[model samples]
Target: MKQLIIAEKPSVARDIASVLGATQKSKNYIEGKNVIVTWALGHLLGLKMPEDYNKDWTTWEMNTLPMIPKKTGIKPLPKTRPQLKAISQLANRADVSEAVIATDAGREGELVARWILQYVKFKKPVKRLWISSQTDKAIKDGFKNLKPSKMYDDLYYSAIARAESDWLVGLNVTRALTVKYKDSLSAGRVQTPTLAMVRRQEEKQETFKPENYFTLDLTYQGLSGKLQLKNPRQYKERQELEKLIKQVEGTPIKVVDINEKTKKEGAPLPYDLTEMQREANARYQYSAKKTLSIIQRLYETHKIVTYPRTDSKYLTTDLKQTMKDRLQAVTVMDSDRVKGIIRNGGTVLQKSVFQDKKVTDHHGLIPTEQAPRLEKLDNEELKIYRLIVERFLGLFEEPFVSTNQTIKAEVKGYIFLFRQSKVETYGWKQEKETTQKRVDFKIGQVIPANFVINKELTTPPASLNEGTLLGQMEKHNLGTPATRAEIIEKLISSELMERSNSKLSVTPKGKQLLTLVNPSLVTPELTQKWEISLEKIAQGQLNYQAFIKEIEQETTALVKEIKMSEDNYVDHSLTTKVCPDCGEKLREKNTRDGKIYVCSSEGCSYRRRKDPKLSNRRCSQCKKKMEILENKNGAYFKCKNCNITEKLDPKGKKNKKMTKHETNRLMKKVNQEEEQESPLALALKAAMEKK
Candidate 1:
């Protein structure tokens, strides 16, 4: 009898099938003598929407403030029904004995498989294949030591609880606010608090008042020192600073104290998903979502890196045995550095890098045994891969040893401090060169000195960039590593926040959202507690049902607050342009594509691009660029000057005239492509096609 193995994605299924000797491939699955491998496209099913439970909930109304269903159910996602149906057929096959869950090893991944199993009513015994990397050896070893499905029941329960609770709180609050405020506003357990944090920072920026101050800089024999004060670091009055500088201008400086110490700094921990995201945002100005997408490709498509959604930065103790192989896998990127480390017996495990207790769900992001072809990775992928490789190598390098020296000097009864660091060993910081100049000083020695007074003004807090916002999210425990990027992107898509000059700021809509949202929901405290409870549920320390019951109670209170609140919401984005369909004012909205005008009327679903996207296709008559516009018929290019229109074919080529049937088919294909293809996904697909 053959065992049915279900994977998370088709690409992943192919990898697993290859390792399991399931070479006989079909459209939906691969089969061998003893195994059949099927796959899910991310998630085959999701929690049912409110309208599925009650028809009355279809329309938004204040009366249905809190639409809580008696039981939350799962439904097959429309786009992926074919894959789900195929998996169901394979599960019930006569030759198939038991099923294996080969999805990604995480809470959501477990939910994906469990929902399908529940839907199919598969009564056969089930096992799970849990492995971090997609390398052949890891897959083979995972199957050989498959664990019973019951082992992860708590994790699955936790996933269900999280999904249900989010639906209850997010949907009810979002509906209540939208109906009462007459705007498309949204709030969530994680997203609302995150937006509130940005709004709060913006408030600080708006209310800040700068104060002028002065400081004295002391220079003595090629050494620099700043005047240290007792209370405020800067002198508030210019006259006070001038007097101090005059007193110490020609005074001989006496070194009162000298302290020297040797310090050893260990290498930084390896890349967890959050840390990697933070670094990528700071260095490359990549959005959290962008970095996650790139790293995910490195994990899922290239199979060069391990899991990308991990929270742990430490490897399990058992992974120590495979360290050499992982190091060797990345040698192609920097053969000299990796080979040198391996030759010097530097692959020995360290407690800082290998601790079984610290690893949860998956180990830190590291290269797999699959050696990467540098050419296969695009520019952004190469940047991320290089980060992971450098971090991994740092684990085996020696500690950075330095001699730190601090000197305290007194001139005219005022204390000044000078500090210097001399590097004794570069260690893991091999990429950087130390430029510190060594200087010797003895206590009670007088030195020639000069002083200069400099004026400065205090500045308001800087706006939160993607990197800093991610740091705040990590600090508040707002969301998991896997979901934080999605939350940020959601806030942007919902028009609550925006990105400008590489900094995150609360939009006018977002500022109003904070004032209108429930007071408890605006702070991180509520969500932090929820995240802690969810973690407890995953660890079996808390009952999932009880935790969800608390969330339901909170949802009821939040909805009631919104219903009773007397606050008013103003449509700041409303424009003078009126919607042609409903005679309502059009609201200007900023989108990634560009600004667009959306109808302000809640009941109207009218919107159009404020500025039409220019296409390369030129007007045959005018020889000028044409504007691309879409209608019920599909996308077509029209020339503003020549008043000529042409239909766009499926391949984006222009045709003078096309049949109605062809236009409809092209529109359907275009809709599907827009719905399913992200820029990174399309790029990866194109790259794979090239291969």
Candidate 2:
């Protein structure tokens, strides 16, 4: 009898199949004498939408909301039902004695396989293959110690709770807000809190007040020093400043003390997904999602990196044995760095980097045994690969050592201090550090210095960018590493957030939604506390049913809050177009997919997808993309924002600036296209223009 092994994606399945000797490939699965391997397309199924359970849930009605299902269920995604059917058929195959769950060895991976099995009613006993890397040895050992499926029952329960809780909280709150306010606004347990944080940051920026202050500065031969004061920079009165400056103008500066010490700083831990994304954002301005995609390609296509969606920045102790091979593989990418580490006796292993207990679902992302061909990488891939490779090599390099010298002086009985740092070793990676000039000073040495008032203003906090936003989200436990990128992106897609370059701005709609939301719902503490419960469910410390009960109660209360609130909502998105179905004003909106016009009425069925027929011409006033507007009058260009209109430039017009040769070149191209135009199409155009 053969054991059926299921993997998370086709690429993973092929890797497993090749290793397990499942050489007989078929359309759905690969089979061998003792084993068969198949794959899932990320997620083949998801929780059923509200409308699936009852017809009343179809419309966005506040009274019919909080549409709690008797039981949340699994449904095959419409586009992937064929694959789900194949997996079910393979599970029921008579020759397969048992099943192996070889999906990604994490909570989400478990859910992917469990849902498929539950829907198929696969009754056979099952085992799990939990391994971090796709190396041959790792896979072999993982199979040697296959875990019982029952061991991860708690994890499955936690996964279910997470999904169901999102549906309950997100759907109920979103529908209630949409209906009550007569606008399409979405809120979530994780994203609402995240959005609130963003709005809070914007509010802080908007309300910030700056105060100008002055600091007393003293400059010597080549060094600058600051004199100590009660309120360092706040010299409230100009007379008091002039008095202090006059008092210390010609005073001799005496060095009272010289204190120095040497210190060492170890290399940073390897990249988790969040850290990797943050670094990519800092250096290349790549979005978190973009970084994730690039790293995934490096792992799957190039086969040079390990898994991408890890949280731990430390490796398992067992990885020590494979360090040499990993080190050699990375040398192919960075010969000078890795080769030097290998040439010298490897450096001392820090316990901070090899703790097993600290590792969660996966260890820190590192390079694999395969030597990376630098030429094979795209520009961004090369950057991400270099980042991972450098971190991997850094583990074997020496720590950075530096010494500091602090000089203390007195001016008119006021204490003054200065510091200079000198690096003793450029260790680990060649990072830029503070380099100070070598200066010699003695105790009780008096030197003349000049002082001036260095005036400055108190600056407001920096705005939230994608990198800082991810860091904050992680700090508050708002979402998982795997889900944080999408959460930030979803806020932008919902039009709750606007972005200019890296900085994020909360739209007026986002602020309105935040004000309407329950105070408890928009605080990170609420969802963060719930995350604790989810973790407990995963560890078997808390029952999943109990968690679900809490979610149900929370949902009921949230819906009730919306129903009872005295604050009224107005649909600000109202447009000039009248709804054909209910005679309400339609709202012009932009979605990720395209533009759409929706009726403002809660129950109205009138909504149309408007193909704006965007134009290449840019608006002169706002510089936004213009849309093509064609009517009985004539074809014209209209700017959506500034309402600027200009008639479309007549085609085949000669460029006055073009030289004869250039004009001929342009005319030749146009003539070629004109000649290709069919006779019937030309005739139709002519007839329509005449009308």
Candidate 3:
């Protein structure tokens, strides 16, 4: 009998297989004399939706407001069906008596593997391979100390509870809002509240009142240069600055306090997805979506970084033996640039890189055993890899040191103050040229000390940019790494926010949506509570069912409130013309060039052509109308409707190409898939197939 190892993705599976000596590889699984390895494509199976329970629920209707099934079930997505079949076959093999769940050590990862096992009805004894870092040593150590799958039962329950509750609240509320508001608006547990948060910030910014403040500059002559205010300490009134200026404007000031304190600056904490995205956004002006996509490719395709989406920034203590190897590997890959930092035969061990407390689920992104090969990667991949390497090297270097000076002077009756700080050395900052680092300085080491009194200055309030705004948001955990990128992307896609000069500004549509939507739906506090509750459930301190029940009750009350609201939902896209037959308002829908008015009232035989497509054809994939490109052998159609391109090439470009045999096989496969439908889908079909 062999041990079966299941991983979250193909890349991770390959790494684990290589480490475990499973050299014989198949379509999706690797085999050895004593072990077999397979993988889930993120998720081989997931919780079924309400529509899976009944065909009638496909179209939104008020009657299906609270569609709760007695039991939720799982189904494999169409694309991953083949992979799921392969995994199930491997899991059920008679020789494979024991299984190792090597999926990502997270809630979602646990659910992805567990659901597949449950769906396939596998009865093998299962163990879990929970490792944060994807190094060879880590894998071997993890295998040696595998724990029973039952240990994570509470975690699994929590994950399932989260999925089910999200499905219920998200689907029900989205349907209710769409139907009641009579628009295509969709809301969710994470995104809706996130959207509300940005809107509030925008609102506060719009309504902000700026007050004028005054300051006086004091210049003192010194050998290094003119030293101004070391600290940005504020002044209460303009008269005080003026009085100070009069007293010390031309007078030679004496340095009274030369306070010097030794400051041991620590290296920066490691990179998490949110921090990385924020840094990229700040330094490179890259969008959050772009950064995430880059990191994803680096993780999945290039295999240069380990689990880029992880929230943890520390390495487990068990990984101490491999640190030197990892450092050597990095040095080999990058050479002299990183090698210079190594001490005592290419070893660079530092306290910042060897902490067990900060690590969870996964360590910070680090260079793998694979050498850095930028030539084969795309520009985005290069950017993400550079970020990872630079940050990693920075973790094992000395901290940046600096000195600060504060000079106080009195002119007439007012006090004049100025301060300045100078960097002594770059330290760790010198290791990686890209990573940004800041240091605090000791007071009164006046290098640029040349401040004169009677100089009036008006401080202009600094405007918000992506970096500063993200910095502030991070200080207050308004969003998580997994969500921050999606939130910013949502703001742009929904046209609720726009980027001007690398700064985020709210659009009119964004402001309008914020005002129109219910306040609680967009606030961050709601999601915070939800996250806290889920955390509690994971800790076994809170009841999962009780948490779910509360969510259901809240959602029900929200739906009812939306139904009873007196304010009419406004569709700004609507036009002056009303449907001729139904008297319902007509609205302008988006088109390639402009907009077209279409009568949205149900069962109304009315539609106006404001901006029809210049050409007529249909996209096979999306089943939407599009413009056709006629050629000799075939016509190519680009679906302006859904952005799908279909081959109709006269030059033998395959147009929905499928052989008669292939078509028959496909239909048979579809039938087979339908036969193996989920528990929810089977029940729904049995109950409502005839209707």
Q: Whose TM-score is greatest here?
A: 1
TM-score on alpha carbons, each prediction: 0.91, 0.87, 0.76
- Candidate 2 residue-wise lDDT, 493-566, digit = tens: 77888778888888878888988988889999989999999989998999999989989999999999998887
lDDT of 1 by residue, 355-451 (tens): 8888989989988988998887778889999999998888888888888899999977888888888888888889496466777889998867677
lDDT for each residue of candidate 3 in 1-691, tens digit (9 for 90 to 100): 9998888777778888898888998998999889999887666676776777887677777777766766778887766899888888887788988888888687777887889889888887999988755767667888999999999887888787777776776667666766776665555566565555555666666677655545444443422222234443355566765665455556544444444444556667668877787788877888776677677656655656777767777776765665566676667446766667665344443576667777755777777665656676756667767777877776666677766554554333334444555666666677333432332333433223244323334443454555555555455454556546655655554445667877777655555555545566667676668777876787788888898888888778767766676666567767788887788889765433545577777566565557434454556776667776444755566777677777644666556767887896585444223212223223322322222
lDDT (CA) for every model shown?
0.84, 0.81, 0.66
Model 2 weakest lDDT span, ten residues long: 674-683
Off by over 4 Å in 3: 14-32, 53-59, 133-141, 209-214, 222-254, 332-334, 344-353, 431-480, 487-513, 516-518, 575-599, 602-648, 651-691
Q: Over 4 Å off in model 2, which ranges? A: 237-239, 576-584, 593-596, 599-691
Per-residue error (Å), model 1, residue 594: 4.3
What global local distance difference test value does model 3 have? 0.66
> Candidate 1 has which clashing residue pairs, if any?
none
Cα lDDT for residue 38, candidate 2: 90
Query: What's the distance in Å from true for residue 358, model 1?
Result: 1.1
Worst 10 residues of 1 by lDDT: 678-687
Among all windows of 10 consecutive residues in model 3, the one with the lowest summed lDDT is 672-681
Q: What's the true lDDT of residue 225 in model 1?
A: 79
